[model samples]
Target chain A: MPHDTAAHDTAARDTAARDTALPGAVAPGTAAGPAPVPAAADDGEQSLARLEAGLDALESAAVSDRRPWWRIVLSRLLPPAVALAAIVLVWDVLVWAHVRSGEIMLPGPGDVWNSLVAEWGPSRIGAAVWDSVYRAAIGFTASVLIGTVLGLLIARIAPLRAAVQPLLSGLQNLPSVAWVPIGIIWFGVSPATIYTVVLLGAVPSIAVGLIDGLDRVPPIYLRVGRNLGARGLDSVRFVLIPAALPGYVSGMKQGWAFAWRSLMAAELIAISPQLGPGVGQVMKFAQENLDLPLALGSIIIILIIGIGINQLFFAPLERRLLRTRGLSRS
Target chain B: MTLTIDEAAQARTLTETAVRLTGVTKRFGKQTGTPVLDGIDLAVAPGEFVCLLGASGCGKSTLLNLIAGLDPVSSGSIEVSGGRAALMFQESALFPWLTAAGNIELALRLRGVDKARRRTEAERLLRLVRLEGAAKKRAHELSGGMRQRVALARALAQQAAVLLMDEPFAALDAITRDVLHGELTALWQETGVTVLFVTHNVREAVRLGQRVVMLSSRPGRVAREWRVDIPQPRRIEDADVAELAREITDELHREITRHGRVGVDKGASGHAS
Candidate 1:
């Protein structure tokens, strides 16, 4: 294909020469002057090539090779595993030292594990996890859709951005859990209340993320895009959005976290027979029943799910995005 | 070949003026303030390599921006015989997300080149810039010189008759800049693209351009113009280039001194000593 294109370029040069009577018609590699120094030019070219090669060799970065899969997995998991073990050990020592009178107040890791095995077995926990995960997925998807539109509107429109940007930041700081009272009043313990709370929590961060990303797109990219004939929506599509991907991805990650937290809060407070069993609902029930082991176990499960989602989904995505742009070391 | 012939014909029919700026003025804010570019008139012929030389604050970059249509002139008209001019900045400005070829390909793709032909065209352009080996390399992975070469290739991929370069080699090291000067000359000769190169370096202007234009600072106006009769493949160290660079540098110093307010006598006498 390159050969074909090279031939085409040569042919074009020939035709350009024959067609144009101007001085520019002089063929490539042939000097424009009558008395041309071919030998000197050749030496110059050789040295130029040599100099360029040396500079490239000296300056061009060597992209480091990735670690082996097992090593990567071990490096990622080992620290957290050790941290969890240390945490459990601390909790056990506290329990042994009579930090609390009984299991109702503070259960040891063993009691929590035993309770988890007896009552919250795989099937029960799986059902609870799926219910919460499903709600979170739906709420987050809606938040993303709404937030993207809102973000684009805010980022592009000056008046809207000026009017709403400060408010959006304030909204991000407001706890999504605080919306539960109003949500219950408005929707009365329905799935809509849960989703509404999740959306309230996630949307602000996503929108703010996109706005920040758009804001940080280097001005040079826009000039280059304009120079390349990218105008209006084409500029945004080809240049602005892609340049802003890192920020947007980070924003979405934060949005997902917010959504997860909001879902848990909503489920914990809005517990009822109508709503199916979820991790948050289980925690609430365990709390009401004064089952410290189940409550602690549920908290651990929530933490695990959050970390798992971030590691398995968002981490890899952000890593790949950064890696491709040569922004990441690993 | 057909594209080149068509462009050449287009240039000829347009009366040999590849780029013309008449009474071009650009101001940043209020109309009361001194304009960055004040009633500047410049004409570049087809396939001419014209270097715009200036001191700092002379708006050398602003002039290129006006020609490239990145910014609107506050007043006056600028015309290009061909379509939009392709621009290269001092910074390579290559998209970090894209590889070297990908950057060129984006230019091609944005120019409405179909997907199937864009890759081949991009590769050919990289080859033209002698960067075939660095095609798959991302912008951050490549050296500064390599990135600039890719930028030049990407500019070429626009296939605009007029190429506006705003101090494109200003950031490169001495040796790399020298090598690129030769490369740019060769590419200009081969492609017959009209170049409006902006630079503050007198030697660079002399080394590359067929015509060197000097602009005075404090509301940049054309101070002087020199038609460089030096032949092609002129080095920065060439006697003719150095001689011309000396003359231009002296003129530039005088132009800069004109704006001096305090310690002018002391500075002049100190320099004389």
Candidate 2:
């Protein structure tokens, strides 16, 4: 786009040209004086254009050019980039040094790649991914629901808080994986055990997070809410919850971490063919077969899936909440 | 929010009282610590502006809190003809989560206004505070004066007959404070709701109050009374307001310098139980 001064300069040049040409009408052949005047007119117009451009430039922040579309795709692929490269290099180095074993023992990256492709078209690998996704989702949802209610209770009720504050903190310190044996005994290798594991993992983090969030809310907001006629649950819903969003989001992030880790641990310990071939079972199978590349590949896939879920859902949710609340830079 | 002014007036005339306090004493627990507000008797006639002035820790805020139904009065009865009193704090105390418009809307929501009327009512209150253009701005984005104005609008939206303010302009700069004082008095006169304002600034009391009640500290009690006969638009430096302020301030000094005097005054007023 041309600068705003360009038009202004043209108008100035027109006026200058008119001033010089008015006397030139008397003698057209004697064009030397007119020639000098036109050049001067051009100079004046150019200066005017420069001045106008400067003003426009000063008035606005420069608009930035968009990055290439390739960058968007590259960002999505970048997390797995180093792992992919390193694995390839390791496989090549092992084979070149004659350290690679047979297909079932210390399998090469190419062996795992072939296994993934062979399993892909049959829909089995897709089913496995979806199975894990669905189970984890159910567990996560249940934990969020139960954890939020318990957290709110602990935050609001004096007696409950007194009874539960220390217990909650203590429970949080105990790893959810430690409860796997009990969860298995209680609910067997079914989704029930999976959910129990997930809840145990996530609930404490969420509740603790919510408490932290609630604590940070200013006392003045409570006073204001009351003065505005916010009584009982209305105050909590409208005032307390929104005011503590940052804490809530952080709590959610922590809860997701617990849930993901717990699900992986649960599946690893309580694997059954009846329970479906999820990522944890795949990891176990690869390890038992002594296929190092396949084991590493399964591990890599799980990490990628976890990160993808976060980036696709929770991260965006958090970013938007922060942006709307002006907690994030615009 | 259901405390209707029309009903309050009809009830007051029928019942013959707007607010009545008898033997109200607020005692904080400790061996060395004294009662924040020892004993007090105060009565507010309808459409009156009473300024409560004292030093810090004189229980000015405690008094406001009690009247606003935020806390129970210890050892005394505070009766309001209005069901509940609306309160404004020194800090704007607006919810940062809500925009200026949204803050006003919360009050309206509590008042049982439906979704449709909330926007219009919020806009009306915003204009009343001379802030029609700032409705969409978040609470933190507003200037201190603007935030207080939004807070005032929210309080007004509560639709209570009594508006209790605890140093609502204390955090504001002088020019904004002066402007707000004028705006407040004008609004008070127009609304005709009883006002009980608490402040540590003596001249603010004289400038804004029709009757300034001087409070003693370390066991707050009514130390003295000054009837401010100054007309509207009075400045703090006005000879009349300053002269009255000096007189009251000297009494405040006496109250602070000495100990146990506040209790004696309370007992004499028959406000000590």
Candidate 3:
């Protein structure tokens, strides 16, 4: 009983001395007294090991360790919206101040808003955006799908990848607007013509993007995937597809821009009522009538649609992908 | 004591053996006089943790690649009792596009697990690796250890009874590497999967393996073997582990420093204490 009591008292004294001597609980006897210090350090070493184990437990990243769902949604939505609002407010102020001819060259926010409303009106562009949307969606969807298929066909098969690699690169650099003439010859003065223009313009972007993405995938991933018993289509779908999605998405974004521009260009050059009215056709009619607000309005609407799609759709998707990988933020 | 397992022994623990490489030889056959591995003979029993320790030119990776079925053996044959073996590399090599969970789920999908089951399996493996909450985390988002754990989960999702690890911890820092060693050791014990670990670090071999196999430096051969009898939860700095590593280090250094130079081992006594 005396021995136990003595050991307990010694431990209490040792712990108190340790607390007094060290910073944040390293044994005080370590630095103070040399004799019995090694003995003290044995305790310190054991404690240090416990501390290390605790740190491992504390710092380890858990798989379910995600922020709540709505928080993620808000975190993603807030930044882009703030930027968009800032831009809109600045434009409104500049136009209200007549900084760049609210009436002429840099039409004010109200003027742009008026154009937005007027265009979407029963007679004007309410119907027009739907046309552009349809054409844009169709063109973008088709190009994304077709270009991905083409890119995969080119990337995987050695002979095909080699043969079409240069062809794809060359196609990317060559402007799709240049293909308008060829498109006109093939599918002239109709919806087919506009769709053709969009196709020619957008397909290359998607295909080229997919190719680059595929090329960027590290060879180690393939080796590991193969070892994991994933092969052929299984490899491509699970490994290649997911691995290449970021690049593929970027390609889709670029292809969208091309398709939109191409459709507008086609509509402006060759107008037909059966072809459906779009921003381009509306802009053409407005310009002809000398209605500058309406013309400028149509242009603004197109820009807004593009901006909205990028900010609302693709930007969030990209952020989510990058953030999930812990690539974007620590 | 006995490496061989008899029929009754096999029946009692009837799990499939991990890997068997017989006369395994990998030869480029271009200008190099000999093949990478010459008549390599090796076998790993079920749930056995084996480490292949060799110097750089020994083609240890090539041997692993063959066992993994990533490359065909030039001469010998590799047999695994399970369906196939999954490989993990030095680089975590997690797919950048997918989240940590998504990456594991893809492995499940390829294994033809149902979509609903994949998420649960992925989550379960993540928990096994102590990365239970990092399901949505991406590759770069993780610290080195975290990424490795996620990758380990992904590798495990393949459901292969054999795991071929090619120096998977060579890139980590001392502290992170230590933690990972514990995690790996624990997981290996729990899973009962055979591990064929190839590494250059002698201490790492001592720390992780139940059996350590050393290959000769140039155009690798089975140089020596050590059966580790130390208890688990080992650290690299453990006196026994360090002592074994030192002995193997002498052999490894001798093989690495001299190419058949007759007994001029003057540097042995002069090494770090």
Clash totals in order: 1, 0, 17
Candidate 1 per-residue C-alpha lDDT over B95-189 given as tens digits, one digit per residue, 9 for 90 to 100? 98888989999999988999999998987787667676788989888888889999999999999999999999999989889889988976887
Per-model CA lDDT versus the true structure? 0.85, 0.76, 0.77
- Model 3, which residues run further than 4 Å from truth? A1-53, A57-120, B1-17, B29-31, B96-128, B133-141, B153-159, B186-191, B231-235, B259-273
Candidate scoring better on TM-score of 1 and 3: 1
**Model number with the top lDDT:** 1
What TM-score does structure 3 among the candidates reach? 0.77
What is the DockQ (computed on Cα atoms) for candidate 1?
A: 0.37
Sort every candidate by DockQ, greatest first. 1, 3, 2
Candidate 3 chain A: 10-residue stretch with minimal lDDT: A28-37
> Model 2 over residues B79-187: C-alpha lDDT tens digits?
8766788999888888777788998998999889999999998887775665665678776556677788889999999888888999999998786687677668656
Off by over 4 Å in 1: A1-43, A61-66, A93-104, A121-123, B1-15, B261-273
Pairs that collide, model 2:
none
By summed lDDT, which 10 consecutive residues of candidate 1 chain B come out lowest?
B261-270
The better-scoring model by DockQ among 1 and 2 is 1
lDDT score at residue B205, model 1, on the 0-100 scale: 95
What overall lDDT, based on C-alpha atoms, would model 1 receive against the true structure? 0.85
Given the true complex, what DockQ would model 3 score? 0.25
> Which candidate number would show the highest DockQ if scored against the true structure?
1
Alpha-carbon TM-score of each model against the true structure: 0.88, 0.76, 0.77
Q: DockQ winner between 1 and 3, please give it.
A: 1
For model 1, state the Cα shift of residue A126 in Å: 2.4
